[model samples]
Structures are given as structure tokens and as C-alpha cells.
Target: MTCALIYRGNDILLCRDENDKLSFPVVDINNYDNSEIIYFETDGTQYAVLPEKTAETIAGGVWRGLRESWGELEPKTWNIAAKGAELAHFMQTNRFCGTCGTALVKASDISRRCPACKREFFPSLSPAIIVLVTRGEEALLVHAKSFRRPFYALVAGFVETGETIEECVAREIYEETSLRVTDIRYFGSQSWPFPSQLMLGFTARYASGRLRWADGELSDGGFFTRESHPLLPSLPSISRRLIDAWLNGEIGGK
Candidate 1:
């Protein structure tokens, strides 16, 4: 009923048991009494976050990032574990009230309350739009300035205030690749919790304009047919799903 997500910096602790099956070092909350712990529940299962020192002591080996061992972890485990990490990070950063500078207390399972100012804070999630722009038999892929690697991905940007999801999609595609797109259709969505992002995926047909980078944000971009497609983002991402769907002729009517 109870489990623990132990984190050390950007990495997480994955325990390898005697049977050689990898699992999280989950423990019953009642069995381990820790005053400095904050527990949260997801899907009727309770989970707690371990402190840095406790996590290090318990972790035999640490996985550098979730992406590295994503395939090994189950989808449910990944989602809950990432949510646990996000809650832990939120609690750590919001130790005190921002408005009144007073120590905050747990308001609910997923919120914090300031006693002095009666202010409540909850976990923050940012929404972003990622679109696969297609032109006939080709899809537009872009290389962003922020990517650590050389592979290309679908055009994506954060949704600005006062903008609809469709508008954000159109604007992001244009801003990043200098291309206009129409027939925008909702494809799918994914919860990308690297630091809490909800990625909204869409498929849009190329309306007009040539392929051109947005100078500062985008390094390069171009439309490529399935036969001549360049390197792409890895699996386990909505962007990759969109790209794969297009390549498999699932998006465009082939």
C-alpha cells in the first residue's frame, strides 16, 4: 500500500534485488517513522519521498535519469514515480511562504498552505504544444537551439497566456520553422514530467511558406519524406510517437 521514491540529485534510486529484478526501494510508511517526510497518494496507493541522505544510504546504485532506464520501468511505475519526484521537488522548494515569509504547512495531499497569509500553493505544471507538420508525403522536423544532441524533433513551444492550443500550435510551427500550417487536428497527449510538462500533440498540414529556421530558437529544419528522413528523437516521447505515426502513414492519408 505504501512505497517510496528516493531521489539523489537528478538521478533516482533503483534497487536490484537478489533475484536480479530491478524495482524501486518501496517501504511501508508506518514501518519507517520519519518526521521530515511528505507523503502523497496516486491511484489509491500511498507514496513518500526520501530525504537526500536517506536515499543515498538506501540506494545501491542510482540511475542517472529516467530516460536512460525508461524501457525497464513499467509505465504505471514511471508515472507514479515521476509524480512523486515532482511532489518532492515542490515541497523542497516551497519550504516557506512567498507572500508572508512564514513557514508553510501541508494543506492537503498535494498542496501547501501558509498559516500567516492563508495562501495555498500547489504543484506547478506547464503546458506545451508539439505539432507534426506534414506536406504531402513529407513531415517537417526541426532542430532546436536547446537540444543537447543533434537529432531533430517536431516543432514545439510553451503555450503563452491568452492563447488557444490551436493558436499555440500554429504560432510555434511558424515561429520555429517559418512555415504556415492548416488542418490542425488533435493527435494525442503525454505527461512529460521531466520537470512537469503536459505535451499536447497535433497534426497539421503545411499551408504555405518555405522551410526556414527562426534564427535564434531554431538551428535548422526541413521537410523530409519517409525514405529520406534524418535522425529523430527517441521513443517514449509524444514527439516520437507523432513522428512515428507520420512515418508509418498513420497521419497523412497515404
Candidate 2:
């Protein structure tokens, strides 16, 4: 029997045992003998991927999106599910070689090769910068126009061509809020695989600028301290972590 992460569109299948603990279902690997299923191993656990239609045929489980299941799953299980979903997405999107029209073959567990073009392709990751900008004690938080909810988050943007991560951090803040920052320093990073992104985090001090945000990009922008900040992002997100660190006097000072 092998533990498997069953996927459907953007949801994963999970089962609850008698103890009410959520887990990926364990299935006989041979059951999917002819279907196109993905298989991989990590930290000594062998895992497989089950298509929605096939997995639905099996009884006893509920399908839930990764975001909704974040608090329910153990850290290890959540990481495994996240990795499986990312790999499944990559394999599904990269079925053929871009250089040539030839079908690609498994070059390795995480790579594919085009036999004709002799080109190998791996899972693509887009790196983005998320920063916490400080002015004395207040942190800069912005409400993007695209956010589904009205919650405010730190300044962030995808790294652009010819620009370093540090440059991206400064540019994102300036472009979005018209605020310049200094003392740009590394804070931490997170694997934000909402379709594959590596979030690089940083901390910076406000340099000088009045709040004049780019129209259509931000709805509101301002600096706020721990007690006065608006509704923030939830825990387990690097954004929240950065905010917590600032609130707790972990990182900030000009």
C-alpha cells in the first residue's frame, strides 16, 4: 500500500480516521496499473497521485483546497501535498518540448526530457519579493486592488528581468506606494506554491516619500503600528510572520 495525494482541479482528497485526524489515503499502487499517475518519494515515504475521476470512485474522503486545509494538516503532510500538487501541475503543463514538438519523457522524478531535441526541462519557479518596510515603529502595509478581501499586506512584487531581488524589493514598494526605502536586508523566504512561486522576504527602513500610490494597483496605503494596524493576513504565511516579528520587536529600527 502507498499513501497518495488525490487531486481534482485545485482540490486534494483527504480522509479522516476514527481519531478525526486527516490524512492522505493509502491505496494499493497496482490499482492504477494503466493510468497516468505520478509517483515520488520524500523523507522515506512513498507517495502517488490519483486523478479526480479515479479517486472519486474510491469511497471515504472529502476534497478540499490546500489553502482551506492549511490549519488541519500536520506540517509534514501539508508539505507533501503541496509538493505533489506542484509536480502534478508541472507534469500536466509540460507534456511536450517547447524547443521541438516532440513528446517529453521522464528524465528523472522531477524532470522531463525531449528525446528529439535532447532538451531537459524541470519544474519552473517564479521568485517574488515580499518586504516589510518600517519607519521608526510603524510598518508599511498596502491593500492591493486585486485582493479578494479588504485585508492589508506588506509590499511585494515578482522579480523582473535584469533586476536583483534587492532591487525588486525597493521597486515594488516605490511603484506601489510611492515610498522609497533603505536598509534593505534579507529576512527569510517561503515556498509559496500557489501555482509555483518562491517568496523571498526582506526588511527595509522607510527613506522618504509621501503616500501617492499607483492608481489601479493599490486601494489603500499607510503606515501603522501593532495596535493600530488593519485586519491582517492569517498565520503560517510569511507576510504574517514578518508582521508578527515587527510587532514583537524582533526586526525593526532605523
Candidate 3:
């Protein structure tokens, strides 16, 4: 009811007191000036985005990225709180209407309305497709240029407008590794809120082509069997789930 998600920049405020248990600092919202704060609610819980100056004053756990805090927070709490954080980011960036430069006001729980232009903007979720491409006992894993570390992951790309998920899957696989794939079947989906993404998971069978990096987009890639798999992405990611499924023989009909 009275919970808040205080954030500073891209990091959230997580505190671990003398006992070393992780928690967010509880703030008295009324004490803060409303104009300087951004707040939102998710599933009946109130969350406030503390100003950087204000957040820095709180004592305890260091500010951490959402991914870094994941293991310390409950799964359901992290999911809901992360949504609140995303909403906070949206509101901060959308404070004014693009067309008329008018200040936008909250239209509903998840949208803002521009009174002058009569335009309503809602929170956006960018859809991305991540697929595990299998060739018999081996699966294709790739290292993208954007990854923070050198771990491998399934081929993934954002779904373009006017393209189906399956089409996006096929295009991304080929674009990244020059590989053709078939049996593009939905596996599962996840809400990855590192700035808002809906990850659509799939499993596909390699139809043709050899593993070749897509120049600037992919650094390296190859088809690897379970016994010879490389370092993987974080376990909390759907990419990891798809990879694990393939490794366990849950996919590819092995």
C-alpha cells in the first residue's frame, strides 16, 4: 500500500542494513514536494521515483541496476516494481506533448493526454523475437555486439512493423548468422523491462546455411551441442530458458 520504488537515473535504490537483507527505503511521500517527484501505481501499490538528489540522501544499500537487484527481490515483486520503474521513465520523458509542446496530464493509469492536441499516449512495449535454432543435437548461439559481456544467447531481434513474429524470427536468424530455419513455433514469452521489451520466445530447426557473423551486428556465433556449450546469458532471461529447454531435449524433437 505504502511502498515506493525510489530510483536514481537507471538504477533503483536498494538498501541492506546491518543484517544485510535487501529492501527499498521507505519514504514518507507527503514530506517530499510533489512537483519534484514522479509517482505511479501498479496492482494497488504506490511507487515513487525519487529525485536523484533526494535518492542520494537515503542511507543503506547502494543504487543498483534492475538486473543486479533481481536475485535479491521476490520474482512477483520485481516484475510489478519493474513495471512501475518503466512507467516512471515513460512519464519523465513524456512530460510534454511532442506536437504542441503542451504539458501532458495523466489520462488513465497507463496513459497521458495532451489537452491542446487531444492526443493520448500510452506506455509502449517493444516486441522482440528470440529463438533457439537447433540442428539435430546442436543449437545456434550468438554473441551480439551490444552485449555487456561475452556470453552467448539465442538469435534475437526486434519485430519490425508489417512483419509477423515468425517472419521476424526467420529474418533475424538469417540476418545474424546467415542461417535458414524452419518450424518456427512459439515457446513462451517474458516481459523484459530493461527499458521495456516483450520477448517472444520460439524454437526453430536449422534448414540451411553455415554460421557466419552479420558483420557489425554479431561478433561471433556457432552451432554447439550441449556438451560443448559456451558461457550463457543470465538465467532470469527467457533466452536462457529457451537455451536450457533445447539442452534438455525439450525442443528440436531429439
Best by TM-score: 2
* Alpha carbon deviation, residue 9, candidate 3 (Å): 2.8
- Model 3, residue 158: C-alpha shift (Å): 0.7
Better of 2 and 3 by lDDT: 2
TM-score of each: 0.92, 0.95, 0.91
Candidate 1 per-residue C-alpha lDDT over 1-254 given as tens digits, one digit per residue, 9 for 90 to 100: 35668776567778776887667786656655566677777787778887766664464755647665566677888877778778877888888999989999989868899999999999998999999988898888888889999999988889999999999999988877778899999998887767778889999999999877765798887888898977898767889989999989998756
Ranked candidates (TM-score, high to low): 2, 1, 3
- Model 3 has a clash total of 1
Q: Model 3 segments beyond 4 Å from truth?
A: 17-19
Candidate 3 structure quality by residue, lDDT tens digits, 1-254: 24557766667877774677777677777877776666666676677766667765576647777777777777886786588777877877788998999999888757899999989998898999999988888888888889889899878889999999999999988888888988899999988777788999999999998778865698987888888988998757788889888878888656
List where candidate 1 sits over 4 angstroms from the true fold.
28-33
**Model 2 TM-score?**
0.95
User: Which residue pairs come into collision in candidate 1?
Assistant: none
lDDT of 3 at 209: 86
Tell me the deviation in Å of residue 94 in model 2.
Answer: 0.3
Q: Cα lDDT of all candidates, in order?
A: 0.81, 0.86, 0.81
Q: Which prediction has the highest lDDT against the true structure?
A: 2
Model 2: which ten-residue window has the lowest total lDDT? 29-38
